[model samples]
Target chain A: MIKVLFFAKLSEQLGTRELLIESNNIKDTEQLFQHLLKYQADWSGVLNSQIWLKAVNQSMTTKNVVLNDGDEVAYFPPVTGG
Target chain B: MISVQKQDFNQQVEYNRLKSKTSIGAIVTFTGLVRDINQDQRVSDLTLEHYPGMTEKCLIDIVRQAKARWNIIESTVIHRIGALTLSEQIVFVGIASQHRGDAFAACEFIMDYLKTQAPFWKKETMESGETKWVDAREADQQALSKWNLENKC
Candidate 1:
């Protein structure tokens, strides 16, 4: 299974903080995001927002980054802290 | 060293922890405070949220990058999370080096990158009892761009 995380406003909109997805067929962050879209109607709208940002395994990454089992991925809005 | 905690930090304690040997002649410290006002709104308090594991990794990466680009001898960073009231200290960065230039430059570099690269987010509570997630500022992104451009050549 792959671990998925949401933070800040994204977590509020999706109403979920964590999820575990079956590792089959998901190859990259983009694919995982698409897989998540199936579970919630508002996921697409919130994720597609201009301020959305992502991280894979605690590092900032683009959507094309390849994923592996047990990897932790996070999606959230742009950060606003010192 | 980097710490992300909900507890308030003592600046003098953090400063002494970063003090280096005799060869290190300069120390620079910066503290970020929670403002009571922002964009014409009166902010009463702030709620800070961070991606737990990711927050530490991001901060460590930023510090590593700073060390790679400067001759820094010692450095420490402490960031507060969770609820914070007006005028409370929110973040502290301390750096020690042999020269003033490297100490100053590295301290600023870490802060600039940390502002954009870290996972912490802030939600502000206004005096009217309304709360809103603070928007990311373009100014912070621009601050990061300068470093990227300088390092390219």
Candidate 2:
């Protein structure tokens, strides 16, 4: 199980701040992202947009980063907060 | 030093705290207030939300970036969270530098970046009792772009 969180515009569009995904063989962020796409249509736009950032465990990460059991993952729009 | 919290800050105390003995000559201060109007609409109050641990660390990182760009003697930032009434203080920024120019520019620079890059979200209450989230302004984005361009140069 991996916990995924969204914020701001993403949150409003998806109507939730957090989501849970279940996978036994999902090994990397790319796989996690592919899995996420199935859950919502709004996510597809953000994922396909240019220059959006990704973070895992509070640090910025790329799509290829690996995940483990109970790991936290977050996706958001271009982080335009202050 | 940076803090993102729900408590109001004392400007004088924060100013004195940032003034060190190491060649400090100027202290620049900026205080942002919750105005009665936003987007030409009469506003009653505002509720600010922020990421708990990440917001504080992000503020400190912004201050650290200012330090890298200038000869800052010291700096302090206090940002208020939670619900605030009209005419309430929202944030404080203080910067100490060897010269006034660096203090002024860095102070403005930090505030500019903070407005766009920080994780704080504000929802405003209108006179009709409606709540609306504020959107980021294009000017704020352009303000950050100046530093962005400078970094690459």
Candidate 3:
């Protein structure tokens, strides 16, 4: 399974902070996002937001990166803190 | 040293620690404080949230990058999380170097990068009890661009 996390406004909008997803056919972040879109209809809007940023395994990443079991994924808005 | 905690930090203590080395001729410190007003809204308090493991890792990486780019002796970064009221301290950055130029540039560079790179978020509570999430500013990203960082994400 892969670990998925949401922070700040994204977490509030989605009403969830963490989720564990079975990797299965999820090949990359784009596919993982697509899979999640079906998990909840409300999440479609959140995922479609252009301001959303992504990270994989604690490093900044694009949606094109491959996903693997045990990987950690994070979704957040652009940071504002110093 | 890098720390992400809820407790307030002492700036004097951090300055003294950075200045412990006599060889260091300059010490620069930057402190960020919560304001009572933002965007013309009257702010009563703020709540800060962060990704735990990633926050510390990003801070360490930022400090490492600063050290690599400058001739510095040592540095310390302290960021406060959780609820805080107006005028409370939110962050602290200290750097010591043999000269003021390196100390100044590194200090500013760290703050510029931290504004956009760190996994932190701030929610503001207005005087009317209304709350809102602080939006990321284009100015902050523009500030980071001055460093010419290759867009990693």
Candidate 4:
């Protein structure tokens, strides 16, 4: 199972702090997005937006990065405040 | 290197704790406080929100970057989360270096990167009876862009 965390407006919209996804292990970013889209109707829209950034274990990542089991991935809006 | 907590911090306590005897000569610290006004707008209180694990990691990364650039001797960072009112201390960053230049530069570098890159969010409650989530500033992105990551994108 892969761990997923959300933040800010994304967290408010989802109404859940963290989510677990049982999958065949994601090999690419596209598959990760597809897998997450299954969990919620609006997941795709939120994840695919330009303002949102994805991080694996707290490191900024490219969309093409692969994933592993038990890895915590986060989707959060950009930091804007001083 | 990074702490995002919900409790108030004691400045002298934190400062003394980071006073390590290493390759040090100077220590520069920055204390971020909750101000009464923002851009002439009367802010009654400020709410600080942070991503659980993400904020700490992001801050560590920024600190590591500072280490790469400067010969830092010691460092301490304390950030508060949750609800905060006016005149409260928001953050504390301490940097010790062999000289003043590196200490000053690195301290400023950390603050700039922390303000623009970290995942902490803020919502302002104004005295005029309106509250809104603070928007991300384009100027911050521009500040971060001075680093070499534009083409990498």
Candidate 5:
């Protein structure tokens, strides 16, 4: 399973903090996003509204990066700390 | 040392820690505080949020980058999360080096990178009881751009 997480405003909008997806056919972040949209079509508006940053296993990553089983994926708005 | 906590930190303690090294000749520290007003609106408080594991990794990466580019001998970074009121301390960055130049540059560099690259967010509570998430500013991106330009020259 791929662990998916969201933060800040995105999490509030989606009303979810984390999710676990079957990694069977979800190859990357883009695919994972599509998989999510298939379940909740309303997510499309928030997911596409702004430029979301992606990370894989605590490291910043691009959407096309391949995902593996047990990998953690995160999405959030740009940082405004410090 | 890097710390992400909800507790407030003492600047004197952090300063003393950074200056403890005998070889260190200069120390620079920057502290960010919550103001009562922002963008013409009165702010009563704010809540900070961050991704647990990724926040630490990103901060460590920023410090590593500073160490690679400067003569830093030691450093300390502390960022506060959770509910914060006006005048509360939010973040701290301290750098120690053999010279003032490197200490100063590295200190600013770390802050610039932290503002844009770190995976943290702030949501403000207005004096009127309204709440809103703070938007990322363009000036922050420009501030980081300055360092990129410096690296090329």
Candidate 6:
């Protein structure tokens, strides 16, 4: 399973902090996003509204990065910390 | 050292720790405070949010990068989360080195990276009873880019 997480405003907007999905046939971050959109059609608006920062297993990455079973994926807005 | 907590940190304590190294001749420290005003809005309080595991890891990576580029002897980074009121301390960065230039540059460099790269966000509560997430500034990205250019030269 792939552990998908959301943070900050994205989580608030989506009303989901975390989700677990089967990784079968999900080859990369882009595909994972597509699968999520298919499952929750309502999320497309906020998800596609702006470019999000993606992370794989806590490291920053791009959408095309390959994914595997058990990998943790995160989506968040640009950081605003000092 | 890196600490992400809900409790406020004492700057003097961090300073004492960094000053304990006898070889260090310079110590530079920066403290970030929660402001009452932002973009013409009166911010009453702030809620800081961060990804648990990723926040600490990202801060460590930033410090490691600073150490690799400069002659840093020691460093400390502390970021507070949860509800915070105006004028409260939000973050602290302390760097120690053999000279003022390294200490100063590393301290600023760490802060610039932390502002843009770390996984922390702030939600502001205005006095008008409305709350909004703080937007990332384009100037921050520009500040980070300045470092990249300097490194290349």
Best by TM-score: 3
Docking class of 4: acceptable
Q: Measured by TM-score, how close is model 3 to the native structure?
A: 0.97
> Which sections of candidate 5 miss by over 4 Å?
B149-153
lDDT for A13 in candidate 2 is 64
Residue-level lDDT of model 5, residues A1-42, one tens digit each, is 999999999999999999998999988878888887765868
Off by over 4 Å in 3: B151-153
- The superposed Cα distance between candidate 3 and the true structure at residue B133, in angstroms, equals 0.5
Against the native chain B, each candidate's TM-score is: 0.95, 0.93, 0.97, 0.90, 0.96, 0.96
Error of 6 at A36 (Å): 1.5
Question: How far in Å is the alpha carbon of B21 misplaced in model 1?
Answer: 1.4
Instruction: Report lDDT (CA) for all predictions.
Output: 0.86, 0.77, 0.91, 0.78, 0.90, 0.91
Q: In model 1, what is the error at residue A53, expressed in angstroms? A: 0.9
**What is the C-alpha lDDT profile of model 6 across B1-153, one tens digit per residue?**
899999999878899999987999999999999999999999999999999999999898889889998999989999999999989999999999999999999999999999988999999999999999999999989998988833210
Model 5 agreement with the true structure over B1-153: per-residue lDDT tens digits: 999999999988999999887999999999999999989999999999999988998888889889989999999999999999999999999999999999999999999999988988999999999998999999988989987733210
lDDT of 5 at B67: 91
lDDT of 1 at B27: 96
Candidate 6 has an fnat equal to 0.82
Model 1: native contacts recovered, as a fraction: 0.78
- What is candidate 6's CA lDDT for residue B124? 98
Question: What value does the TM-score of chain B take for model 5?
Answer: 0.96
TM-score of each: 0.94, 0.81, 0.97, 0.83, 0.96, 0.96
Residue A65 miss distance in model 6 (angstroms): 1.4
Descending-TM-score candidate ranking: 3, 6, 5, 1, 4, 2
lDDT of 3 by residue, B1-153 (tens): 899999999877888889888799999899999999999999999999999999999999898888888998989999999999988999999999999999999999999999999999999999999999999998998998999876432
Reference-based lDDT, residue A26, model 1 = 97
List the candidate 6 regions with Cα displacement exceeding 4 Å: B149-153
lDDT, residue B53, candidate 2:
60
User: What is the full ranking by DockQ, best candidate first?
Assistant: 3, 6, 5, 1, 4, 2
Candidate 2 chain B lDDT trough over 10 residues, lowest sum:
B144-153
